[model samples]
Target: MTEGPPSILSLAWLLSLVYVFVAAVFVVRRLTDKSGKELARRIKAATRGRDAATDAAGDLVKRHEMSGLRWLDVFLSRQAWSRRMDKMLAQADIEAPLGIFVLLSLVLATTGYVAASLYAQNPFVRLAVGIGLGLLPFKWIAMRKARRMQEFERQLPEALELVGRALRAGHTFTSGMGMVVSEFAEPIRGEFQTTMEEINFGMGVAVALDNLMDRVDCPDLNFFVVSVKIQNETGGNLAEIVGNIAWLIRERLKLKGRIRVLSAEGRMAAWVLCLLPFFVCGAVQVLNPGYLNLLFTAPLGHILIYLVMGLMTMGILVIRKMVRIEV
Candidate 1:
């Protein structure tokens, strides 16, 4: 007797497993690959469009591609939103192509819809799951960007003090930044190294600093860049100025920490409030299996569920705004 062909569900599961394995491998390679080959490739691609005339003139400003595929790169280049996404990826230090993320999101959304259909018969529930899963990539990007910016801000004061010491030791400003590149760890080191490379490649100090500011969304970094630009114009005691800025940044960080500590209660309350409804719903389902069946089976129940969800979202936003004190 011959075996029957696999069911559609089995095929879907198999495909999902393969996709997950491939994505995991890709992520691991991206995280561990430190050969700088990718960076070199991007630099080469960026410079490929420049003429020798521009090269000779030392105008080596390169336009980076958003995707590996020529068509996708061209399409992304034309879209403002894609450019913003590219910048967000850069801020997060993610080296993956934008097209990969776009494709991944679509795949995830489709997978989510299929998975939801296995347990949920409502179209709205399936759509909601799909949208939620589709947003995971972007949400992850945002979280990564936030963590990186926080780390950068945390390192800025020490990096600045190091630069200040180098300046006082009679090194040029660029030399001070180079020292930072050599001495500091990731994020700070990478950023400074990029700025140094840009300067070496004929980009002006101010313009390079501006680019750095664009790449980092830290207000404290804005202060450093503005101070450097001002000092270059006015011929001040650069070392003293840097030291003062470092001190100011350190104090502000301390104050921000204290503010977070004080608002800890509010943050905790917001979290509990956000999670309570889901916990209750889950408990109700477990305690009495069909008690909440109407919510999934009836139109009126669906309307109520949506309204409750909308109100919960509004409450969460308001609570977040109340607790988030900008320092």
Candidate 2:
């Protein structure tokens, strides 16, 4: 008969007000900044003699605002949202503003909270679930980004082989990359196409490659960077160096695939074991009602459950470590 702590509507209103205040301060500082003005001027200058796409790009950069919350930005840098956005953008071929993602994150958090609240039987349990849901998308995005990076790494040697052949045939790096865009398919082609444009717009090859590496964070790209850097420094046959690098990468990728195959069963077992307790508890509470109520209904039961969860989590990690082979 007791009322819930507060409706989700109330929580949303509080969050909305805080977001508005933060946004307003951000806007105010941006409006007063000479740095923003200088950057805008530079973009205008860069795109002045260019075509419609370049002009649109200039406008997009000028309008793309990321100000305030420097602390949060730094913290999230450790969390890797930029890397996630990069892969998502490349895959989806979406050119929408980054702010759209910020909004999407909030919406995702709310959906998490609502889903948790509906499934959880107790107010305290529901609150805990809601908080977890709120942070779920960030973790989800990180996992998605990692998977995409793995895929990209697996495909990189092939892309490099294509580029190496084109470069040896007397094509400039930019043109060679454009060849990649035309000849290859999604992900590699799309990412290279963007890099090609960035290079055309006055960005240096090294800088563009670094930017691309930042997006993927793949180990294969690290080797490619090393090859390029060495070629730039020592004046060797760049094509030969790239071809050798591609061979090494392909071997590494093959090894990684075999290791993954060997580890799959262990990883699945760890996942199931870790998840089983929570699912069983949830199902029991839903079906029998009183069966698992004692856990939350008593302090001792709550502490015992928490201890069990901690142990189970530790055990899962141990199994995960056993199966994880870093190549």
Candidate 3:
């Protein structure tokens, strides 16, 4: 039996919607794929080098391992984020920075607002919470990046010493770096390997070194770069200079570690103090919902809550700053 006209019309409408949905999915995938390819090209182009041929190709492959919305890259500086991003990117060898992260944050914020309006009993509060939650991923990414970079900085002197020994024993600077790249763990190995590869792709050694320092953006790395640059310019004993710098870095790392150990209790105390008030309020809400009804529903109560939140946020920042010991 032939289908009726209404059945045909309904089928046509359903097919149209399906086609539209499929088209959207394909377009999104195509765009993301194109963007990935472009980022890979940029990384390879920028990280070229001589003798080692270390391009961003390998690093780019590593970067794709992350969930793509790492919060750590947002709040941290390029120095910290680059190291963390490098780890994530290195896993997948992704050559791009965290541009996709920013996009994800905005999308999350939008999603939170929409979800809150549709499902939350109190839209404004839920929306605010959603935005805060959306910001959380970036913060996490930043912290991870900071910690990783700190670890790298702490170990940099040791790696430098290894390279210096190799250089003194008659290895070329490039070969010494290659040894470090192979022997040292990430992020030192990963970073040096990338630099070595870039240099191998025909970039000048000085420029490649500068690029590495730029990406690292650590004062420790900067010091090494300065020594290298000066040695190149004035014709000094490069290995000896690097060796001394390595010693200084080790001393600094030791001092910083001691300070961190001493300040551990204070840091822990600050975190607890900062979080206590929120914990109490959340408990009260759960135990006596009516007792806290005004906090969300009343205009005056909402304002007060915001004021309190602002103050709490400021207090946390102050405590964090007080506890932070810059080495």
Candidate 4:
């Protein structure tokens, strides 16, 4: 017998092709990657040392600038959805092209739709599952962004203190930022590094700071930036101001920690209540698949399942709202 066009084998092939394409793109990118800034730094060194070999290497880098998946960028640049995804990716410090991410999402959604349509035999369920699966990449990006922001928050006070110390040691503001870039761990270090580069690239202090604030999306960073700008304008002691901001951040962080601890029980209860039904249903299904098959076969069973799912969703949202205490 001949196989149909939309057989399992064909779907698997399609999924494999997508994965192969993604892997090839990323692997090639990694293999060919060069550091644009590093090359510039080397060119400066070569000029200072008057070395012909170093100049040649730096010139080669300039000639062959590092390339990314710019085709996707060109194609998706006009779309609003792609723009929003780009912003999210920027905040998350993701270096992948938005087009590539969207392509992966499309492939996953297509696979999910095909597979679920075959197994679930319900159009609504297939659509829902497909969309949810498609959004998994974005969900991952959001989680990464949240984690980076949390780490930034944890490190911001210490970074500020270091910057203040650098200023007190009679360094310029840019030099102080360089100190943070050198002393701090990741996320914030990268932020300061970018800002320093921006300033070096002819951007003003206010503009570079605004860019930093835009990239990080942290209010505490906003406070620090604004304080620095104000101190710069008014000719006050910037070192003292930044130190005070650091101390203030410490106190606010302490209060926020207390609030989080106090709300831990509510969060735990919310999670338990939200996931209990699914866990019980899974247990029952494991015990007897035939028991849940009735829900797929009977009209009344569909109604009950729909009602229960709706109520569970509402309960989850309510609990989310109740437990989310913003500082």
Candidate maximizing lDDT = 1
For candidate 2, lDDT tens digit of each residue in 273-305?
988887988898898988876777698997897
The best candidate by TM-score is 1
**Each prediction's whole-model lDDT (CA):** 0.86, 0.71, 0.72, 0.82
lDDT per residue (tens digit) for residues 150-234 in model 3: 8688779888998899889999889989999888888788889888998897888889998787666468998898888888888
- Model 1, residue 200: what's the lDDT? 96
Better of 1 and 4 by TM-score: 1
**Cα RMSDs, all models:** 5.6, 6.7, 10.4, 5.7
Q: Model 4, 1-327: lDDT tens per residue? A: 953447678778867887887788778666655556656767777777657645766677444322355555456766777767778888899887565577678877887887787667679899998999899998999999999999999999998898899889999889888988888889989988999999997789999999998888788888888987887788799899999999999999999999888889999998888888889989999998788888868999989989988998898898889878887
Which lDDT value does model 2 have at 31?
Answer: 58
Candidate 3 stretches greater than 4 Å from native: 1-27, 30-103, 118-127
Candidate 2 ranges beyond 4 A from true positions: 1-63, 66-124, 170-172, 278-289
Backbone clashes per model, in order? 0, 0, 40, 0
10 residues in a row with least lDDT, candidate 2: 64-73
The count of residue-pair clashes in candidate 2 stands at: 0
- lDDT of model number 1: 0.86
